[model samples]
Target: MAKIYDFNYKYGEQKVVLPPGKYLLECWGAAGGGGCKITDTNLRSKGGYSKGELTLKKETALYIYTGEKGSNYAPTFNGGGKAMMHEGLSNGETLYCNGGGATDIRLIGGSWDNEQGLLSRIIVAGGGGRNNFETKGGDGGGDAGGDGSKADSKGTQTNGGKGQVGLDGSFGKGGSAVSPSSRENYGGGGGGWYGGGSGYNAGGGSGYVLTENSYKPAGYIPTKEYWLENTSMTVGGGIAEENGKAKITLLQGLPFLVISSYTSEQAVFTAGHTEENKLSKIEWFIDDVLKEAFTTDLYLEKTINYTLEDNALHTLKIVVTDINNMTYEKVVTISKSIMPLPTNANLQDISTKLTEIGEGFKNGKTSIINILALKNIDSSLNNTLVELSEKIKALFDSGDASIENLMNQLIQANNTITQLNSKYKYATGTTEVQKFSGKANMYGGKYGNTFDRNINDWIKIDNLGFVPNIFYAEHENVTVNSVFYKCVVFAICNIPIFSNEQDFTIDTSFSKEKLDNVDFRAAGIVCTNNERDVYINQNGVCIPASNNYFNLHYRWHAIKFI
Candidate 1:
């Protein structure tokens, strides 16, 4: 069986020698006392606790430093407190624990520091800071072990000290003030190694305003409690001796579970223990549901990854058990949300679409303005095209046929069609034309040829000939006192006829209509004379006109420029 040792005192350094064996080392740092007001009773504060296990060799020496308690008023005029520790007297590289600070009027509570060692395995609890005069009571200490009680401000009697036992273990309490009834008041007691003691306010003592057998302040008494069962361990005030050697038993500290990293999608957790082979298992739970469990050796230093749902609150609980049947548990709450991180594939897709749009616009295959307008009208590209198609149909249905309006509509339609064609990569290069072939008569009665044909006879051909362009039929009529003659021509390729271009030609011949008997018998007149005058116009039409009686024959030929 392993022997146990213990140590508890106000302030001292003691050396202990141990043989080769496995042993547990436990330590508790001292706490600072609460500051006192001129008229208020001073209070006492509590300290922190640290423990670990180690293997010792033959002739190993360990130096222990017990921390001192906070003073009522003397040390620094309502100053702070301190904690205890153990050090290697030879190398001075050993485990250390810090105590809570003392509270002054309106000062903050003492802060706890992390334990220091090779394993870096202990956690220190800090004491509470003192309150101001206007405030009623002092603040409580940290929850690492015990919580300190608040002071009373109502009435003349001073309030009692706080309790020691906290959620983890026991620490110290704040002191109380004196009463108004001429009774002596005492400050709260400091925390011991294992447990913390309460403050006292006893009667029948002499001090300030000394009266025989009057109320007076009493000295502080250290308190201790047993944390473990079936062990020879003693804590609190005064040192303990066992088998002519100092007996000290250290409590096993809980393991540390830390969140290494966290995000909306995943979270990483890490667990660690101080002693090797002391841990039995580690279990993880989320929202009361078991996620994973690990059964492994002690001295755990493992990390775990957990996937989380988006935009939700999650609770994580980690339970660790040691080989000694000692268990430690930790819990954390985290909220996750969706992260807007674009993937490579998404970016690539967007880039490809944009490239296509840019190339189409640059090559004039796409109308950027219309496409942009369509895009503005609708967010979806496919839907924008559908809406544009509907709008175009509506535009055409309005039945506005003015040349200017029609031309504008034609331009818009061209742009829209071009854009659509580029988007779908359609082929629209082939051209088709409809030809026109028809004949019209020109009336010679309007001219001086004595013909019965009308002069206003005309014809029009759209998209005609090899080029399938436009052609218009034109005729000129002339009359001289009941005799009429006319010229007919066709304008081809374009509406406006130009001079010297033989677009199409017309030829006409005429016979004499009547002969005069006196003109024939005259010496200068020949009865057989049937000569007529023919004239060609700028539009390439031959016109025949005469005073003689004549009939006419007409023929036309189409000439292509290209």
Candidate 2:
């Protein structure tokens, strides 16, 4: 049996002292503000408990990352870089860099008038590559500006001309604008009339970032910074509109884990964004101890090898400064389990199953969800299979007719898919399935590509799990007149969303008589595939008459009677 270390939120960062006697570990997590709860908490906490304080165990740190990312109901183990990179918000997915850790890196919030964000490094909101009869708006995005042909190569420049509204039509769009200053790796920018090259880290217009504030995004806060480089949002290249705005803001940081203990000739991390930023130079260290430094544009990613010396448990922190000078830090510890059988085969099998099902579905072909769901029960995966078996049995039960049960089965299937997060392109790939276990396959680089995964991050998009916003009433199921106060004072925090509840509030006022009248109003959640809507008391689902709630009396719209 493993020892359990209970957490309590008492300080910003907490340290636990254990007895000398060694014991097995069950579950452990880092305590940020004092002794924090390992489970979940109110909206005031955002319940993003990611940092794992390993009490001597293997996979402990990784579990923390998984938990934190899943806490928001996000499916991506390593984020989509949504916390800091708004350009990544194209799919409205949240991701994080497993490598860098820059100082004072905060999220700025905003929104766009467009249905989705037209954000990229070099967005072209204006006209581009237009002529007599065959021309239109410029390509809008980050890294690359609007080039005529649509090839937004980082170094290669493109020229597009504006179309003439009257008389003679305009010519090709403006030339490609390459970031000559950056001689390093960059994402290819799209083409447009006034186009730029593709490059990662190059903030684009209408580009988005995920950050929280007193209120929500698109709500309008003129006093806020709505545009700039590293400012969460950049101007779009050429968005068509008299002044049509396409705003994108931060939802939260992508969840990530750092493996500092496995530093080989190269340092490495397990993240999805690494492919986005192909690294060339790697600066590594351990507690200020200079471990190594290298430069190679072929693949700027670093790798961590499990060496004999690293067999012992030792705290290690590696700070990687990518080409953009954006530094990332990952802290990891060596575990006792030095060697183990790689599950690449099992993971690949699962991926293949999903791919087949997805392809069949997309092509309007037949799909056996039952068989697909059974793939999760591969006997090789012991415990998980057992748990799933029980759930599957429930699916056939007479009570399975209920919508809740059906939805629960889908949720279980989704969770099963999540377990297939072994590696990207495990088998089917033009390139040898990027060796994440042995090489630096986009663990941290912005130029790294986000390969196709078995399950999409969309499963956990906007996954700020069941946050109970403040309702005027404090008890269990709140009321309608009080529904006006759901997270009103404080926008439910995402990344570090809440410093403390004392910093926020809601409109809680109900007269004793009015409160009595406020019946049948209950707080609950309505679930979709991955998105969940939380409604406080008296909002939607009315509380049953047999309400098991902590009822009380108060002055209607009561003010602190001084």
Candidate 3:
């Protein structure tokens, strides 16, 4: 956002200190008070306007001088010439009005005292001159002061005052006129960069701008106006009719903080203001507590612990201050989901319960053993169990060794299969190869050719649905003198594919004896993101001086290890 400061008519010179930034300055000079004659009225000329741009440093002090309008009897403020009294008038003394003062901005300190003070003026607007009998005062100047209605000449940058009889105006004061006789009573000149000449009616002062981008509007009668094209500084004219005015508007803005991206666990941000100033310091805060402070760098990538409590939320605050001492801050809310942990009793209680359960189980097993012993007294049951056990043992000991050998063989086969599975496992859990090919038109490579790829020459191989881990391309040129020219390019597409960085390698082999005139310079291959298109450089002169195969045929194959 831009800020504006205005300076209106005041008693004396005013000063202001501005920070480092670009600014537009505008000033309007004051108009002289009207003068009257016997049975006739003279019209007062309006003030001239001046505008330009300036780039100031920090703590730059500027002095503003708002012109004060001239009056018939009182002395003019801010360097307007005083009126002259007519002599040899039998009907009492007749006094003429004085010239108006100029409005300007001065770099050096102190009031405008002498002509040497003109060196400190950065910009100035000319004031209108006093009027004469039935003759209107001239308007203020853009480059040079306007001539007075009387026999007085105008002032300019080269010469401050131009009239012989008129009191020559200096840097801040307007030229005063001499009234030798009652018929020769004239008004004073207006004040400006160079004060105007004085005559029966005074001349307007000259306006000035330090830079070339200044502007002065057209049609001020005697004074010519000028304007530069294509600039932010707008038009200027006789806008100020009474007292002069000055305005300073800031063109550039201050710095502010921006959060580029943020997540529950990570955040990326920048402390950037205007291009004119750099950041002085940056502080990061979490939940109202200061976390870290940085000075040199404006960009930061910070990790946050949002999962401190189950389903917890955290507040992130970033504050940045620029070199101008202007500060800005931003706050963001982030949250993370966390699983709750189960609560359990003390360890001693759990151990006691386990011991009781184990003792009961042991006692129950003993009771079962005693009952079985009592039942063993039944001779038939005991004999049947013993016979069944003997049969099973005899079968294994006699000829069942073959069954044992078969079991061992099965175990060995299972162990061998497990080893193979361990050695051949895929990291991605899939081993699928997708292959596709197409035909393309390309120019033959030239000697010392550089790889310059064009987008239009690329061939799209889409609908694969998945990004390939690796890419392999084989291109074959048409038979040159009945010999096939082959090029194989292997590329590893960057993750997300659209990244600027990509890696690929190309290999071309040929016998020098076969085609000595042909030069295999370079081969370029690229696979674009999302579209999965392949682009190859096709800008090169054809090889072999005898062959006119400029449009070489190419068959490309794209292999994707899915």
TM-score of each: 0.23, 0.19, 0.41
* Runs of candidate 2 exceeding 4 Å displacement: 1-214, 217-280, 286-288, 296-312, 338-562
Better of 2 and 3 by lDDT: 3
Model 3 clash pairs? 255-273
User: What are the Cα lDDT values of the candidates?
Assistant: 0.31, 0.24, 0.55
**Candidates in descending TM-score order:** 3, 1, 2
* lDDT computed for candidate 3: 0.55
Model with the higher TM-score, candidate 1 or 2: 1
lDDT of 1 at 281: 79
User: What lDDT is obtained when candidate 1 is compared to the true structure?
Assistant: 0.31
How many clashes does the backbone of model 3 have? 1
lDDT of 3 by residue, 299-373 (tens): 454433333342233456788777777677766544343111113422233233223323322332111011111
Better of 2 and 3 by TM-score: 3
Tens-digit lDDT string for candidate 2 (1-562): 3335442212111233332222221111110010011223210001110011112111211111100111111111111011112232334433221100000001121221111221211111221111101122222322222232223321111232221111111111112122333332122121221222222221111111222332223433222222223222122322221111121222211222344223223345543222244333454455346666655442434465433243322334555454445445554332233221123446445545434433333342121223333323446454554455356434544443443443454456556656444211111111111111111111112335422212111101121122223212232234554432221111121213233221122222223333344544333221111012222221221111111222322111111111
